[model samples]
Target: MTAPAPASSAPVPAAARHAAPPARAHAGAPRWARPGFWAVLALAAVLYTWALGSNGHANDYYAAAILSGTRSWKAFFFGALDAGSFITVDKPPLALWVMGLSARVFGFGTWSMLLPQAAAGVAAVAAVHSAVRRSLPGTAGHAAALVAALVMTLTPITVAINRDNNPDTVLVLLLVLAGWLCLEAVRDGRTRTLVASAVMVGLAFNTKMLQAYLVVPALALVYLAAAPGTVPRRFGRLLAAGAALVASSGWWMLVVDLWPAADRPYIGGSTDNSVWDLVVGYNGLGRIFGGSGRGGGGGGFGGESGAERLFNDVMAGQISWLLPFAVLALVCGLVLATGRARPVAAPPSAEAPVGAPPPAREDSGARRDLPGARAALLLWGGWLAVHYAVFSFSSGTFHPYYTTAMAPAVAALTGLGGVLMWRAHRRARAWAWALPAGIAVTGAWAFTVLRRTPEFVPWLAWAVAAASAAAAVGLVAARIGPRVRLRIAAAALATGLAAGLAGPAAYALTPLGSPVNGTNPTAGPAGSGGFGGMRGAGGTPDGTRGGLSGGTRPEPSEGTPGRPAQGTPGQAPQDAAGAGTRPEGMRGGPGGAMSEQLIAYLKANRGGAAWLLAVGGAQSASSVILSTGLPVIAMGGFTGSDPAMTVERLQGLVSAGELRYVMPGGGRGGPGGGSGGSEVDAWVQANCAAVDPAEYGGQDSAQDGAQDSARDGARSSLYRCG
Candidate 1:
């Protein structure tokens, strides 16, 4: 028609001139997008809440605390091991507060106790979706946001932890909220918004102490670099936000510290009954340096410390399925999505002379998207990097469940990277190879993870490999097949998504098939032992797996295997090996039959005593308290190792008639040592009368060598003290 245009004079598309397009307003997005977001959340809710009660009193250590909290506001505030408030749990009580409030309102039962975490999981998925959608607006943003939410919802560890009672569930939600708030501050340039973001992190700190700070560097750096303000103003606002962070995180710690030691419960996991010591020595540097937690046993749980630790047998099933793909996305997104903003032309105005070049307005329209895309890449990429570094190599107690903290970052980057690569593929750019590369790596990794549990859905690994290969090939074919590009792209996306998600989706569904281990929740087949085979191969009698001990049947202390140790009736009664009221399904408790008898005996005989029984550790005391809702003092705390009770303290309780019964091995015996010893054991042996095991329907295990074994075994006979 008109003269053909020269190569140099061809009209440039708006996208070619700008690094990224501005986000479209939420109201302008397709109506289907809103419904799709809610659908993702609904899916998460169903996944988290289904068959939750199968995990009865999940992590009864914390479950016991929740019950105690329901009975005593003091216990609720302090996260006490028993209603008597003798000692606090090792962790802070923010999570307890949420579960406690729910229990209080709904009545403390399995459903009420676990529902909060399930709700928190859905909220976390929602937070991730919102963060991604708002940061990357328009059609692409919607796709990325939905994909991110779906990935998070299907993450194996994310599903397992949310259904259980761990504090990590709430901690993950709070951290995500903080990330979103930080993003909002960057978009709006508001100091108040930034302060709110810091407050969220502080709350997360209270949830899990130092673990919550993992995302702080990313949150602060993103704002400092990309927020709409001068460098000094951003720094000043950050200072103010930092002050807010300190205030919110410290108020509870300060209150607990200032309260008179005699008036409040003893701080658990501390060498000297100080919360500060627990924070600094046990939960802090001790976790990273090793040998700082209770009994100096912080030598990192799960597996060996190295860059590949996340892929180890103990952890790979829980989190590694998507890890390689997330890493690839992070690298490709950072490299391909970054570019200088082009000077966009403004629409001609009335005052501008005819043919005058429109004033070159920089950072308009798509140009603004460059900083946002890069900022998002940095925020999520840094989150994944920092957590990966810490969890993979930190020489502390590294439970597989701890990987839930990485889920959001992994989900976000996968969505972000997939969407960015798809955009490149559509344009037939050099970076189009990213999509195929991501699919291939993710498929291979998923196959590898599935092979670890070969018996579990054995066909799934081959299916994933096939889908990934087909998808990668289709993506390559789309480059030259212009007439069929749309069909190929859609098929490739479906196959790639199926390949990427199949392994995690199968793992995520495993929790529903059986009750996951309460103490260390791992998402796999029933006998997967927990992270690194921490649980015994077959699991425990009550279905709760033991920590470090693996829930193996205890070797007989006397008589013969599988029989209670026999001894003189009046001698300090020996452990029946694994006997006790299985008050709940917590590992290291007396067998359910034995514990019922024991709880019944204590309830009947606990007249006028301030405490119904005093046991060696929180493990045993938690079992007893959960059974009766009565005060049972945990003598030494978590491992029977915190030195919460001494000979003098036990004597004072006996002399005051506040404590009447004593059992030594509540949890792995609080024996004599440089670290808080069993002087209380000696005191009780001297001043207390051993009740005959026959008196309470208990087997007589008090044979030769029984006393020594009693300190480490699950069940010990009752002793009566005036």
Candidate 2:
């Protein structure tokens, strides 16, 4: 509904410069009234938001943080992990802000907390659809929009994150929204839309730190080159947008840093109390290069895999299905769909044949010859390439699920190229050949990708390859032979697309069919499975993690692959991933249905201290805290490694009679948790009496039923302290 953008080389219109594009206006138009649009949205909403309450508190760490945040504005604003504000979650507070507000309004529970992510998922799908429609033209544009939206929505990793309370969900939405705004800026030659685009990126930064900025380079390039302006003017406008970006993302970081440290939670991921340290050291480069920079305490991606991890067994199934196709699309679109000679204008009295296709989209190959289209190329292609390269090359600690960021960029390029090539094919031009080439390339690549999961769909890959080969053959025959009907080529292309889409569609549907629980959850034919379940596939020792080079396996219970260590009966070490700990909420950690006896024991002995008991980290404490509404300090935050309370500080809490009992499950490098709780854990072991959890009727309750965190829960152990 935006005012028709003038010629790409023309001067900007004043009215177009002020108003935002009416992207949402399309929802009410006749085009939307058609069945296809509604069908896509309806299916997306069902997949994203249905059966919302099943995940419980999704990830215990963030769920506990939400409980703390809702208690007061300070905790909410600071991303505190508890009401006492012991220490904040490692990242910024924007994601917690949305989740905490939902928990506050709806009253904290699994469903209320996860609702935001589901809503975000739907919004992301709609936003991508809108972006495609606005950037491409014609019915091909609408068709591409549907395909792109579905491709992104059904991506296994996107589906996995969107179904939980993960910050990645919000981050993905914000990034795609920026891409849409940038597209509008180019179309209208409006600097204001560019401002909006920058604002969105800044907000994304608040959601996930430097990871959100991966696409910023492409955004700047697109706006400067494609936006209606002289070179100097475009540069000036981009400078202003950059200023806006810095101001928006920096405000929260400044507030957190400038706030008196003693009055708030310690910044958990940092070795120092400084928030900027947490950003630049841990969440930023430290993720790529490992070793939390100047901040003590170690970090790294582990092993020498580097960028090869992207296509490895762990990640390939989740985010890579469409990656090959996207790359192919971008190259084809750039070379085949650019620089077409402008068609000679037809006379006013001339009428085209009834069966002839309509003129190409207004922004299709002819207009794409303008600088703006080339800028679009840089925006989308750059987004995909930068993220892929960084994710592949970074030596810092990374998770399999982080691929959520790449989904939108890949989806956009796929849609753009598909529409252009489809339009280009009608003209019988040399570039039109890119269509068949694309089909063949994607089909061959897909066959290889599918080989990794042969057990999943034994014959499905062959079917896809055969259908795609046929489509390519049909299209070429239509081009070279007089008797071949073009309709045959169209049907063949449809069959190929449907065939190509089947594997990922099945993968995405996995989570919907089964309960997903773990940090790096993946979707497959049967259902969702944790990253732990998939790890033994990559040449690592089976059922155990290989140690650093020049080392034998870690000491049993010392930094185990999943749990940090094992303690006495009823005890397992906390999750040990440290500041890089992938918080899986209730679904992660050594989870179990804590015994009723343990709950009663804490309640009966609550008189001496403000907390019933303090444990190693969120994993060891979340279920108890949630079930009993009692204060249990998760001292290490997510991984027990956050120096949240030094040994001296904890001793002070005990001396003041503000804390009493200590849980026995926490320790250094010994199973499930990070390393921050060692001093106190050691102090308890040396000074306190061992309290047999069995005496309290906590007697191996879940141990008898099941030992896994996903089903029953982790073992529990307790210590008596004075």
Candidate 3:
């Protein structure tokens, strides 16, 4: 009676034996929605927004400007354009189109331009969370999401790029979405999911051309391996995925192909080639191989040296911090897959016969616990590796930013590794001792690197040491007890996350030094103020007059009682053409007051069309000139070409009346080559005789009085063309 009848051989009811977890887990919501999650998200948002806004304008501003203009839209998409045009078709236009839309909605302001990128970054974090949830258990998913966000937050380059209006941020987000879709398609064999993957790949192409295709094959291969039988069944899904990619990317290709050859610019010297030639040869092949006829700009590590360049620029520059975690995850995955470290099973039940022990589970509970985790890890890691390998070994110039799309994959792999370590070591003592130790060491290393400010190499060394130490500690702790190891691993992860954030936080806090202090204005300006002074008369110490005439010269003040004439002997003005222009519409007035004079000059001299050539070490001038209706060109050495040569060329146009005026002030040196000591003044005086006296009279009298009082120091001169 006491002994229970032998257990029935019949299987337990499916419902009674196992109940699926709720679709919505308590932890599914971010800590921000919960008090903790909210606080974290809010703080991060604020920090990131401030950093994004505060960053100085990057070099890509030129590209952004070209993209933002309504007229440039077609050129933005197709490679066929005028020869020697800076606005040539280079990158795909999808990102620019998004940015252009944002600019349209919010107006062409910096904040508006960057808003899309910031939004993309935020969405990426959410995407990572969704991806993890779809691919792993609830706990691991949450961990992975947290890790992804932290990784992004901590990466300085990521923060800077996302803050700017660049295509990389959008590409990265699209890639992450595609990755998640690929994982879903593999696990569920859903056609829609596969199609989604294809669409994302297409968007990625639009964002950055062919670089986005790097991940597709890797994802497909991993999926094929993970679901061996499903591939044949889902062959149609694969084709659909391919179709989606083509649909999304093919339109641009076709449009570009049909574009007239005369309209296309010689990008990377592949001009005179057909649109298809430009797309595949220059954009496609030139991007990965060292071919002069292709779009390769002779800048990247193309040819046999590509591998080295890839490691240095793409990997080390972009994803250096994640390399350690990636390596560790790879090793762990390979070991687990090969059965080298078989998961330990629960001991046999107490009632088992003396000679018989219950059979070990075929699908280890570990695998069931994180059903798609291994597959996801393999897919993402392999994608990144293969993507880099393709580019690294190719003969095309690869920019550091190109690798940014791989960051999400690396972050996901690292997160998976962390989750696995935590699962294996569940308690504090087993791994926690090393947690503090690793943190302290890594933190010290970080401090050292910070002090040294080593860009890529030093950072890599410390990251490697930290990762190795953590892995050793984790493995040892896991062997002792799962609980102990988990606690330690969790602590270590928290420490690493915090450590990662420290660099970006500190960088964000630091002020961007002035762009003007350097010898060249292209170096960036020093002070942070509206571009008023640079556009106004007081922009320079000398009383020279300057204004935003697309290509007109500064109007001269009539006559200052004490101030010497423009062409006074030994006082020839130096050329100051490339300094950025002031904010749009601002002009310096009498006694260097903020005058509408510059704006008036722009209107008067531009006569409907003139290219504003902003010189000096000021960005404000360019900003001001652009704000005017006239097409503005930066004259400063921003183009890496000689500013003097540019000025000479502009002068030739001005002499030909193709360009009418030249505005000199804005803290830039005035034009040189006046006859005698007064050559400049005389030359300007003779040429500008037709300018309205009234225009110079107001500022001239005041500046004259000021000069009379000072009697020695040279004041800025503002001259207008006759």
Candidate 4:
């Protein structure tokens, strides 16, 4: 056989043997392998940590309520109880459950309540990096990850919800994970991938109800379109996935259903509803259309102006920062498709044509060149479009924050845009500088708007305008050489990033005024009280205002049976009765200085449990009172009446022997002892107990004297209960 053609034996070149694999083949490496990736990740951590520290108590009211007591594992995991009532109907119980559990573990302080959200935010950044790395080469992937981190850290809405004890953060994280899973499944087409996608979607549903479902079908459809014949062979697997979701989420529904009908006011109309109805109808349909069937009836598109509402709420709420980039990415994606670029080489074929001409390479290059970037843009862009379109067209009361699910997607797309620009031109290499520049600009913007006068800083608005202008210019200039176009693109991205960060930074530094009432002064009239108001007894204007008191207090025997008396003044009481006891006089007595001040006023009034009131306070005071292991009602009156009317209007709770104390010094009732009392103060004194003059310690009086007498009276109240 000619000695096997005497195979030549030339030593393999070390350089050839050691050469690294092609970018497409090694694209899926973990972010930790790259220094730039770690740098981006570290930046995200620092930025988010700063946000957590500086942001005011965004959801302290709910966190306080949920963390106040030892919650059942059942309630902590599946059932929504306690503070659940405040956000009723608007969101599911998962978020509260997380907060409750965290509080149980960490102690229900501001940091504790917010810890979970911050952690989730960090996890989201990591997930974004992982997802991007899967399809994009090293440099592009790192660039995209960096961009994503910046977007997540800088966006106002992202910072607001991630740092708040709201469910939005959890939902956002789940959605991002779900997106990653779905995209991964497309790449691998493995059964486990499908199951994972299903599981993620289910968890997402549990976090915020119908929102997860809305994106699921869209994702599935996209997958089917992108990869032919990859869907499950039988519908049974799909059903199984759906069933798993239901099982995971149904426990809460089942427990909630067990609640007494009278106690389940928010759960009304739920029995007749199907799971779809519960999700799509009540949570989804009802919110948009506004009706009693769902939680809030006046929420949908019909009741409000659709386009304007969408522009303000859905678009502006979550992804406004990425709007320009999204458009640019979309245009680029279309261009990429039309150009028929082949970034990835085809698998080796044994019988390939002698000269196939490299599969007709496009002028621009191969599609695989920006695989990760392309995938991110496609997935996130589609997600935003579908999510906004559905919510925008539906008839529901749209709060800008509800769109938090789209935040990760927006960030991903923005990141992709950055990568695409850099890849398009050698000159654009400088554009990568925009990523860090944008971050610095954003940080500065945050300090200015938040630390200084929030009202005066219009950086967010201006940034948006500038970004829009740049996007227009970049889109037209895209046809230019990659070098020149990339510079413009980098500038545009920097401008957008700076703008995006400005809003949240401003929000962080700004007082946000009061935690209970949202930032918007006019939100109340617009019916934008938020789910927090709906779930709780009602909103408390200021924590120090006062406990519930509509009528004269019942005799000790007249209150709930077996109710214990108030405890010793200095000692916090136990159970409902002792918890309800107020200080005895207006001056120094027996209890500790603070206790005496509170108790003296209560004893002098001698009103029933409902008599206790904090004159100058808001819902936070009520939360503090409740946290003392006491039962009390808080009245939050921002204006004409109590803003938290659910608790305010509950004639039964107010009339019942629940109310007991009154504290008035935090400016709720009237400007601390002004000439004339405000309407709230006038009502408190006329209907509830008045502090005795003897109890009133002079302005310069010693606090100890006032405290002892009050403590004695409070102790006696507790003894009376015993």
Better of 1 and 2 by lDDT: 1
- Write one digit per residue (lDDT tens) for candidate 3, span 504-573: 3444322122111111011001110111101111222332212222221133232210111344221212
- The TM-score that candidate 1 achieves is 0.86
For 1-722, candidate 4 gives per-residue lDDT tens digits of: 12225556997543222111223524564554567556756755654454242222333234334543333343243322232221132356677767667767754444455667778877887787677655456666666666676666555555545656667778878877888876765555455766777788777777778777767765666455443242454244456556766776666666665655344423312324233445665566666565542435435322254554534422342335455455565565435433444454555555655575443434443343444344445677788777777666666555556666666766776676656544554333433343333334333433333222222333544554455455445534544655576567567555655555555444332222222222211111111122221101111223111111211112123111112233221122334322222222110011122353444454454456533433222332333333343222233221112223232433344466544444433322323221012443444444555433344442224576545445323321111110
Best by lDDT: 1
Error of 4 at 53 (Å): 6.2
lDDT-sorted candidate list, best first: 1, 2, 3, 4
| TM of each candidate vs. truth | 0.86, 0.82, 0.63, 0.60
Global Cα lDDT for candidate 4: 0.46
Candidate 1 residue runs with Cα over 4 Å from true position:
1-25, 292-300, 342-367, 526-594, 673-676, 699-717
Give Cα-based local distance difference scores for all models. Answer: 0.74, 0.66, 0.47, 0.46
Candidate 2 C-alpha lDDT tens digits along 1-722: 34445668876564343222433435544464247766877777777765554444556667777777777677788887766677787788888899889878866655567778888888998898877765554465577777788788778778777877668989989999998888777767667878888899999999988998998988888776567657798888788889989988889889888998878888877778778887888788787666533222331221244566666665666777777778878887776545655565443433545556555334335553323334455688999988988888776666657888888887877887776777677664666577788778777766776777676567878987898899888777777655655787688778767766776776676555433344444555321132333211221333222222211222123322123233322122222211112122223445333555555666787676867777766666666655555557767666566677667877787888878777644422332344365566677777777776455654455663333322222433466677
Which number leads on TM-score? 1
The count of residue-pair clashes in candidate 4 stands at: 97
Worst lDDT 10-window in candidate 1: 570-579
